[model samples]
Target: MNVCTTGCDISSIHLTCGWFSSARLINPRVFKRLRYNDCLVNNGNRLANGHTISFQYANTFRYPLSVSSVRC
Candidate 1:
């Protein structure tokens, strides 16, 4: 699983995976979404496929047209 937080023009991310028998571990933050294959193999071993990954981006706007216009 992954967790993320953002503020203004900057953002941060964290990732972790559950313990497993395999030495390979994926960073949860690296993918905004993911999927797995039902069946696959290579070198007489099961292979991974159909896994999708994505990233989330934050948008920022600079400068204000009128910062004090709405001040009371």
Candidate 2:
């Protein structure tokens, strides 16, 4: 997962994956929409072919988003 909160533009970093994951940004000053494989969310995103994930937030924040959970 990737999170950019320090005025860093994450436009050049191309990410592709074949698993269930989510990327989110908690910054309240960045309004960057995300492009994903499953659907479009304002914050972080997920690229899945036929996977199901969980989400709880609506409405756009700074809008910058994406994340993944590393199971230990």
Candidate 3:
């Protein structure tokens, strides 16, 4: 899991996984919006994989826009 506070600019983010794992991002700023690009891979393993990425905002009043791209 990753948490960003105070000036954060995630223009391009890359993630590579080989097991059943996941990533999460937590942003606490309400006024500022979060934008990022990501890539996810699972190799060639035929095992049951439950990989995913999620975003959480502390402030629920106004939800910002999030853009992402994933490749398996």
Candidate 4:
């Protein structure tokens, strides 16, 4: 993890089951989400390179993810 030098973003990255979800940068506004079922997502697994790491994930099933976000 060595890809944090200021501004960076890893957003809207869609991944299915058995797939890999990775990010590299230094953006606090980086958003990640899930919409399907039986899928594992990691929002802080640095694979390429970056600063600041976290272990955020979710398991979606049945209905779609209900999120009230600012549509901009």
RMSD of each: 20.8, 13.5, 15.3, 11.6
| The 10-residue segment with the lowest total lDDT in model 2 | 11-20
lDDT of 1 by residue, 29-54 (tens): 34221212111112112112332234
The model with the greater TM-score, 2 or 3, is 3
Relative to the unseen true structure, what is the C-alpha lDDT of residue 54 in candidate 2, on a scale of 0 to 100? 36
Candidate 4 residue lDDT tens string, 1-72? 235454554322233433323344323334343443223223434333364334444335322433232111
The per-model lDDT (C-alpha) reads: 0.23, 0.32, 0.29, 0.34
Q: Candidate order by lDDT, highest to lowest?
A: 4, 2, 3, 1
Candidate 2 C-alpha lDDT tens digits along 21-59: 325543422222243422222233332333333344344
Q: Estimate the lDDT of model 3.
A: 0.29
**Which is the leading candidate under lDDT?**
4
TM-score of each: 0.17, 0.18, 0.23, 0.21
Q: Return the top candidate by TM-score.
A: 3
Candidate 1 least-lDDT 10 residues: 63-72
RMSD of 4: 11.6
Which is superior by lDDT, 3 or 4? 4
> Residue-wise lDDT of candidate 3 within 22-61, one digit each (tens)?
2334332211223222232222122122333344434324
In terms of TM-score, how similar is model 3 to the real structure? 0.23
Candidate 3 residue-wise lDDT at 13: 32
Going through the candidates in the order shown, the clash numbers are 0, 11, 0, 1
